[model samples]
Structures are given as structure tokens and as C-alpha cells.
Target: MRIALFFALILFHFSSISQSTDERAIREVLAQQVECWNEGDLECFMEGYWKSEQLVFIGSKGLTYGWQQTLDNYKKRYPDKSAMGILSFELIIVEPLSEDFWTVIGKWNLKLNSDNPNGHFSLIFRRLGDEWVIVSDHSS
Candidate 1:
């Protein structure tokens, strides 16, 4: 009985460690995106997202599918640095849905020359291969 209990505790410890590592990785991806956005590099910002036709994004404009489509929409809306502005994010929740999936809820703010536009976002991240990438995003 003692041996069984010891093994269970070991398993729990490893599981928690894995989850912590995954959470840190997800946060790093968001940090990279913010840095890319602040630098006015839309392409670089998109590196945080999953580059696939299955990718989905929903915004004030409505539902958009595919990685290229999302990038196109961003370009259409924020054509210049003034429009893109400096981006910041406030994460409220980052919870794991399963071993390979996680959900993030956060507030995003853009500091522009004209005005600041802020909104909340919900993102679903999936572990694909060795990297965690945002597969779906809903922002308004």
C-alpha cells in the first residue's frame, strides 16, 4: 500500500510539472505576439497562430477561417503603424482543457495616436508537434 501511494505521488508531481511547463510556454507565445505587434510587424505577430486552413478567428467584423484570411483582415483593418498601435494584453485565465489543449481569456488594448481601443479575447491553444499555437481566437 505504501509503494502504491508513493508511485501515485510521483505521477502527480510529474503531471503538475508538465502542466506548469505548458502554461509557461503558452504565456511565452502571447508575450512574443505582443512584442511583434508593438513593433508593427503583422507577419511576426501571426507567428503565434497556427498556420493552417483549419485556423479560425472571430472578431467585430465576424467569423474568419484560415490563416491567410486572418492576416488579410488584419492588413485591411490596420494598414499602418498608427492604426496598429502598441498592443498590450491582460490575461485573466489560462486553463488547460486537456493534455494538449488550453484556453486563455484576456483583455487586449491598443494605444494609438488617435484613441485607444480595448477589448476582451478568448483563445484556444493546441499543442501541435513540439509547439503550442493559437488555433482559434474570438475577440471583440
Candidate 2:
């Protein structure tokens, strides 16, 4: 019985450590994304997403499939620095779906000289090797 209890404690400790690490990683990924946007590098900001054909993005226009198409849409919509402006995210929730997946809900805003656009977003990130990349995104 004591042996079982000891193993349980170890497992709990490991799980707690992993949760903490994942939280930090998620924050870092978000920060990097914001930094890329602030620098007006849409391509760099897209690095946070899964670069696969099966990646999905949903917006007011409907669903867009493929990573390249998503990037293209962003490029078309933002156009220039005036459109991209400075970006910020207010994280509402970041929950682990599993050991290798996380779901994030947040508010995103772009601050521009003439206008500030704000929207809510839901993102799902999958652990790909050592990195966490967004596999699916829905923003409105």
C-alpha cells in the first residue's frame, strides 16, 4: 500500500511540473506571436501555426483550409503596416486538452492610428515535437 502511495505521489508531482511547463510554453508562444505582429512580419507571426495543408482557420468570411491560404488571407486583409498596427491579446482561458494539446480562448486587438479592431478567438494548439503550434483557429 505504501509503495502504491509513493508511486502516486511521484505521478502527481510529474503531472504538476508538466502542467506548469506547458503553461509557460503557451505564454511564450503567444508573446512571440505578438512580437511578430508588432514588427509587421506576418510570415513570422504565422510561424506559431501548424504549417500543414490540413490546418484550418475560421473567420467572419467562413472557413479557410490550408496554412498557405490562411497566410494569404492575412496578407490580403492587412495589406500594410497601417492595417497590421500593434497587436495584443488578453488571454481568457488556456486549458490543456491532453498532455499534447491545449485550447486557448482570448481577446485579440489591433491598435492602429485610425481604428482599433477587437475580436474574440479560440485556438487549438497541438504539440509538434518540441513546439506548440496552432492546428485550428476561430476568430470573430
Question: TM-score for all predictions?
Answer: 0.98, 0.96
Q: Ten-residue segment with the worst summed lDDT in candidate 1?
A: 77-86
Model 2 per-residue lDDT tens digits across residues 7-61:
9999999999999899889889999999999998999999999999989999999
Error of 2 at 56 (Å): 0.6
Model 1 scores what on Cα lDDT? 0.96
Q: Which residue pairs show collisions in model 1?
A: none
Alpha carbon lDDT of each predicted model:
0.96, 0.94
lDDT by residue for model 1 (25-132), tens: 999999999998988899999999999999999998789999999999999998977789999999999999999999999999989888999999999999999999
Candidate closest to the true structure, highest lDDT: 1
Clashing pairs in 2: none
